[model samples]
Target chain A: MSAAATPPASSEESTDASSPATGRIPGNRAIWVGILAELTEFTLMFLVYFFARVNHPQMFHEGPRRLSLLAGSANTLIMVSSSYLVARAVLAMRQDRPEGALRWLLAAFVVGAGYPVVKFLEVRWNLEQGLTGGGDVFQMSYYYLTFNHLVHTGWGLLGMAWVVVRTWMGAYDAKNHNGLVAFASYWHATDLVWLMIFPLFYVMP
Target chain B: MTALRKIDLAWALLVLFTLTGVFLGEFRQGGFWVVLVIALVTALKGRLVIDVFMELGEASPVLRRLVRGFGLLVPALILVTYLWGPLLARFNWLLE
Candidate 1:
């Protein structure tokens, strides 16, 4: 359970030495590049909305008004707590406390799952209020940004669930925990993007 | 096994409290200021999550550089669009 008892090697070496090898754990660079690409796509969509809002302010207001701040805030808290739990899980794994890490991973997974459920309800409510994506630029941007984040959140929850299972199986020690690390990074990125989107689209004018 | 460092529980609590305040304050007047403050706080929180929670501080220098580069580039691009592109549109430069 000690760091030395676990593979005392770089993440790459430990990843190679493991059973059912999936090649080297993908570097942080590759993951960041992928995330940046996705963010760029989102930014273009936001810029489109910005131009639309500038040209047609009235079209944007109705959709923005229909957004449920309460649900959005709750999801924010959930994501923040989930990120915190993932951090704690990594710390536990570093301490060679597999059971503790597994528990935290499970908790993080639960909180991550809650985000999309809240988002689904919010989207349903917006639809009921006649704010379809086709209605106007604001509705489209609202769906574009929030649903994009929700998709990321769904992937994050699946990643968390995988981390939980692997941690329970004692597959992640200090050296071989890159999967967990990558999952944590992606989850936090999702939270980071939402942190920007929530206020920009929901709280702000 | 390494001994666990004391969790930065206080800083985390501070962030949570600030976010809560921003959420509540949004319901009142001063909407623009509230949104501005919330965005700033959220950025700080994102940094905290990256540095402390994700242990970005402990990562390899190359990894840190990658993050730093992306951080700088992404915001710069956004600001450029907000400033120059909008100004060009205002001046009707694109129409010419």
Candidate 2:
């Protein structure tokens, strides 16, 4: 997510009285459900990762050393920065600024596109270093979890593409930008997951 | 500060925190202190993203709590696992 509403999102934007959002949850009911499911899936996988680490401490410890920390960190910065841009896009729409929102989302797409690019390089590097899923417990967990995240991020990028087109066509005004919010919600959730993943797989000491 | 400016500030802070995490990983090595610090930072960044970026800062109580709970939960779980890793590893009797 990017910025806040310079003012506040008017009440109409948050139509569902049951929604604690008041202007929260960016997207619609459906999007929140997806976000919830995604988070839960990751939570379970992270647990699996922790358990694997516990069982094979030495592997987990040495595994990351062979992986590309620079690539991981670069991706972290890319994810966070893109997430910031997405938030700004949502905020821009809420303030009746479709052009600004569109611009932000475009920037977000460009930034977000970096994730796969970096991951490609990282994977190539890992392969060269012999870090395969079949290598050991830690490497297996790392590959599975990170690859899972990459797949989800691919979905997010596709969503962003749709959002970008709609946004460009003036499909989202301040009065109705649920699409923007919904996409941002997914993007932000992905960012949150990456934040956790980064430390676990790359930066954990 | 404007919301955009605040977000920019948060972005800078997050970047700094991320770099610090990398440096800590490079210099610190595995230990309880490192685990605790990393988890704490992770929790903090999660809260910031939830509160500001996700716009739950002034949201309803339930929404606030949900996001807040998730923000705290991930790191807490990691920290707990880190603290008792060996003790828990003892249960590897079956797998071993």
Candidate 3:
């Protein structure tokens, strides 16, 4: 709920379309390397998804009806909120508000932790509904993609936990929070993946 | 606007777009246009996260474009696949 971070922007630029391109990387350049890798991994998986969907359109259409929309929606909100909180943490660091930044990161971790919990419950519910056969392309894609995402989220949570500790030690400040920024970049990238995944698996039908 | 307010607005829009996507998914069956709209919404959401939250708005043009390209390309791929999936499937042997 705290304010987020960034170099600075005008009201006009905030529209996203008109935002001035300043040629700045958020944290460190290395983070983008990781972010790009993450994107590549998902890109490959998405190709598989598109392939499966094309071959068996009916299964993809019927897949959503079988899964719980509530769970999917809940996970989407959770991922978005987590990304927002981490962004806030980065902003707090920019303002040289270490305590504030720490709080934001902590909040992010708490919220992000909900992802796996919701996922666990969702998986359990899916099993209870007898959706475990993985016989169809849709079901196979659903489990593989979501489960892969869950694994990535788990890595992100670990990173957040470490970043949270680093923030607490006053390791990052206004002029030198590249580590924090990098973490933010990775988390945002992960969040971006989930955004795409939600629609493909849950909402696209 | 303040940086905080800018991202807050972005976050708000992200949530709004997400809920709208879900609403559309819930009420309607799949179609070319519906899927296109959903893909566009998703691309927009990805752009917001990249430019705003990732603070790439003022960053290098190359980096920004690379990430933004992912945002646009994935949705475009989704659309193309949705439209020509069967034909594409015929080329599955290429993967083999």
Best by TM-score: 3
Decreasing lDDT order of the candidates: 3, 2, 1
Candidate 3 residue-wise lDDT, A1-205, digit = tens: 1123355456565553323335556667677788899888888898888878888888888888888888998899999989999988887777778899999999999999999999999999999988884557888888988898998899999999999999888788877888988888899989999988988877885
Cα lDDT tens digits for candidate 3, B1-96 = 667888899889999998998898788676788988988999999999988888776676677778888788678987898888889889878878
- Candidate 1 scores an fnat of 0.15
lDDT of 1 at A24: 23
Give the residue spans of candidate 1 off by over 4 A. Answer: A1-29, A58-63, B1-25, B28-32, B58-96
Q: What is the lDDT of residue A115 in candidate 1?
A: 90
Residue lDDT tens for model 1, A64-100: 4567777777787787788878877876776567888
Instruction: Give Cα distance to truth, residue A13, candidate 1, Å.
Output: 24
Model 3 off-target regions past 4 Å?
A: A1-21
The better candidate by TM-score, 2 or 3, is 3
Worst 10 residues of 3 chain A by lDDT: A1-10
lDDT of model 3 at position A166? 92
lDDT of 2 by residue, A117-199 (tens): 99999999888988887888888888899999999999999999999999999899877877787788788888888888988
Model 2 lDDT, residue A175, Cα: 79
> Model 2, B1-96: lDDT tens per residue?
456676788888889889988897677577788888899899988877877677677654565676677777769877887888899888878655
| Candidate 2 TM-score on chain B | 0.81
Residue A92 in candidate 1, Cα distance off native in Å: 0.4
* Per-model root-mean-square deviation over C-alphas: 6.9, 4.8, 4.9
